[model samples]
Target: MTAETLSIPGLAKPASRIALGTWAIGGAMWGGADDANAARTIDKALDLGINVIDTAPVYGFGHSEEVVGRAVEGKRDKVILATKVGLNWQGGKIFRDSRPARIEQEIEDSLRRLRTEYIDLYQVHWPDVETPLEETARALENLVKAGKVRALGVSNFSPAQMDEFSKFAPLATIQPPYNLFEREIEQDVLPAAVRNKLVVLAYGPLCRGLLSGRMTADRKFEGDDLRNHDPKFQQPRFDQYLKAVEDLKGIAEKHGKSMLALAVRWVLDRGPTIALWGARKPEQISGVEEAFGWTLDEADMKAIDTILTRDIQNPVGPEFMAPPARNRVQGQ
Candidate 1:
């Protein structure tokens, strides 16, 4: 295809309905992968009309960004590239660091590795209790002013946290984990994001691997991946998680889609947010494309919500939706 056809058709676009999640390109989510695979995965995503790619330096210990740099070479202008700061790479694992100095330094490093002059959407990967939210806010604003970044966002912010940061600058989006198993976001973050005109970039819309339907504990990742660490994998909850997935399997079969597609469609039907489809392999990546542009009907929506709410032990917690007191100021 010609460059124009591949390139994002518009400049200064608000955001697109489909975004390719590059966590798999980073290749460390489950560990034990290569740059070649990551590069090819990105190419496949672009060919499939996924013009938005989200990456983070912490992904693949900075190796993912380097791979992406190589993958998108000669076609940098074709896609909207979004990456995160506030994620630290150290001791062979990723951790959170939202300090203003760190954010600046990491973005510089990210630009160097990604071979980009500026990031399209630079986000605080997560909240840093150690630094004031305002400090992080100001740092992001400076990036925009200097033209080092196009927009700013935060991952995993509560309503109050988003509000506090907005006092300093407009937030383009908020990235949070939302999925069939994690529908609690609908109670507050979704509505609050809508009120503020912020995009709700929903990460983990597939619930790691459960909603994908290829999961089996027999498949294991080395080191402490979030799947192994997440509470749902533990005893009593594991059963609940399995039941929910199995229940959806029937619905997916009836709809003639994989559990993955059903899970993604559920998120897209929720509202304005974009769902990050994590594809570890080319075939998996291809499979997810079917989920695009499809909306879940009311029966499927109600069924999915019932499965999620009834399975979660604490639907009211921050893991689902933050408390109301913390959310009141988010739209202010």
Candidate 2:
């Protein structure tokens, strides 16, 4: 299907598939992060015909937005811009703040940093437990009313939370990490979104590069890298994940696609609004773009589901929290 056919709240659903995720465009792992590389990545995606891009102010703690702004400087209309608020990542730390005042301030800051007056799909990166969900919802609704954001959405929200938040405003989309290794959202979050007719923006669809079958090199990350500290990539569980990656490769080969391509296609095949693909390299961007020409067949999906096995084995419960190279059960 083409972006024109894909209908969502505010963003232009791409007729072709593949939404570029700008997180790594700011360089999360390989430290070559700079304005030039980021701008080039965005330009490359557009040239390759990828239209939708998902980002957040916390990514590189606003550095990502700056690069995105400069990259889309002249061709903003050609691409769909999606960004988030709530969680602030600054000085290598994450803190959630959804107070009315902070939300208002962040919206203005996001507009300035993005170099655009309106954000296509503005989302709350995460729920602020301290702030009443209703208050946060109203703040986002107010932004819409003020014409600051075209659409309002949320990320990493639970089914119950999604329903609660929607009462205050019309939720256009909800982003959650969904991949072969992680399917928690499928159980609750997805049903809620579908019931409400809200778009499901599948983030981390490639499992932070683990599903790409490139882990054979045993590449190591820096101390601050999230994957470096993640339990799934740790030696104890690395082999298991490596096995899963190989399964992806095998399945992709049957379809004449790469593991990366298959990984993206699986998510796209799921009934959702879009998949947020993170690509630091130009080649990765191209590979993701190729995943949308068609959908995966049932037999392929069944075998894939069987082999991928829901064993994230994250010591910290979620894939994002486990310490790097540590056992999923912890201290293993």
Return the TM-score for each candidate structure. 0.86, 0.89
Model 1 per-residue lDDT tens digits across residues 129-169: 66789898998899889988888888888899999999997
- Number of the top TM-score candidate: 2
Candidate 2's C-alpha runs over 4 A off are: 1-5, 11-16, 28-32, 89-92, 310-332
Clashes per model (N, Cα, C within 3 A): 0, 11
Candidate 2 structure, TM-score to reference: 0.89
Model 2 scores what on Cα lDDT?
0.75
Model 1 clashing residue pairs (backbone): none
Clashes of 2: 11
What C-alpha lDDT do the candidate models reach, one value each?
Answer: 0.74, 0.75
Residue-level lDDT of model 2, residues 166-276, one tens digit each, is 899889888888877777877888888888888788888878878776767468777466777667777868877887787668888888898888888888887765777
Worst 10 residues of 2 by lDDT: 322-331
